[model samples]
Target: MGTKKYRRDTLIEAGLLFSLFYLPGYLFLAGIPDPRSFNSLLYNLQIWILLVPQIFMVIYLMHRDDLLDFQSFGLVRPGAKDIPFILLAAAGTAAVVMAVQVTIMLVAGEVLPEEPLWKLTKYSMIAPVFISSLLTGYSEELFFRSYLYTRLEVLDTEKWSRLIFVNILFAAGHLYEGVPGGFNAFILGCYFSFLFTRKKNIHIPAILHGLYNFSALLLTLFL
Candidate 1:
């Protein structure tokens, strides 16, 4: 296929993948007594159930993209130089997120409440959270950066337009989190997209993404 045709096909595939992951969550949230309420176990359970399908869809999409090739996914040893930078970026991002969360709580003059906080720190939950972060980091990078951005680059005919389109979709995916979260995620997505385009690797962004989520979980627990 021509590059343009390939990219258009890839974008359609990505849209389908995103819809599979998000539609059910939207439906579940629709039924909630208070969509934003953190008090209901049933609501939480529904969210968790929605995540299962999302994860599976991500895996299938990544596999289809050939981005899940063991070496590409960081299953092999990375160069020594790449390792240190990746570690530093991940750690730095996590620290910044923690700082932001603390600032928010202080400004709000209230805590995150016990139940949701406990969900983050509980020993049994730690393993699952870590695994989920790792998987999600890999999956999102594969879909958004490797597949979607690469395809956009092929189709847009102009570099800046490709960047803008990719960032918009990246931001849109985070809309469920509210405006601030979507904006922040979009800004972060731009950074990651730039990194991927420059470095020609997904490992760094995956590490950063994982660390960002892990840091958010830590704030949920300890702050």
Candidate 2:
């Protein structure tokens, strides 16, 4: 038999996780007009810094309690057979997201905000955008998909409820983006979550997330 679940503490742990790490980080960066501000960068680096330890904590807690293993959490080391599938998942998901984003753009005919995101023009931002996208993609996916999904598993939430609620929370956490960003995040969360549930691999979702982010960065040229 497996270790007993911590069913009662599910919501408590979720609240604590958000309040302790994400909430403070969001508040710290709230007033910054530009995402590249000293404050914003600090917020970015700080959250990821906190996230590393938190990742370890979640892994340790789950493993110690026998609730998770490398395989269950999709932390398995990719062997020879997994690489191509992973690459295909990432590339295919990126293509789909690009098409969706472009459709949204066309439907709304919205003007791209001046100084959106990194404040670097398309030609000048290759390296910075790549770095930012990778970091955000990896960190967010690890937290939301890998860790939070596990947390939800111990709750009373049903399968569909778990899926919808998790995606909703993911969108809510993207509050920095205001309305449009929240919408985009919700859609991306659903897409990535679908992939995660299907593949049972965090790496798949993370790779796709990163690729999508990088492609979105490239899209800045036209926006």
Residue-level lDDT of model 1, residues 125-205, one tens digit each, is 555566566666766776677666665554545877777777787777665565545656777787777767767777788
Q: What clash count goes with each model?
A: 0, 0
> What's model 2's overall lDDT?
0.66
Question: Ten-residue segment with the worst summed lDDT in candidate 1?
Answer: 30-39
Deviation of model 1 at 109, angstroms: 12
Candidate 1 TM-score over all chains jointly: 0.66
Q: Please, what are the lDDT tens digits per residue for candidate 2 over residues 1-223?
A: 2324455455566678767757775667644356443224444465457556766765565565445566776666656786888777767676666765676588666634455663434465566556666666766787788777766765545777877887787887666766666677887898888888787778778767777777765665555
Tell me, by TM-score, which candidate is best: 2
Error at 41, model 1, angstroms: 14
For candidate 2, the clash count comes to: 0
Model 2 TM-score (2 dp): 0.76
For model 1 the local lDDT of residue 178 reads 51
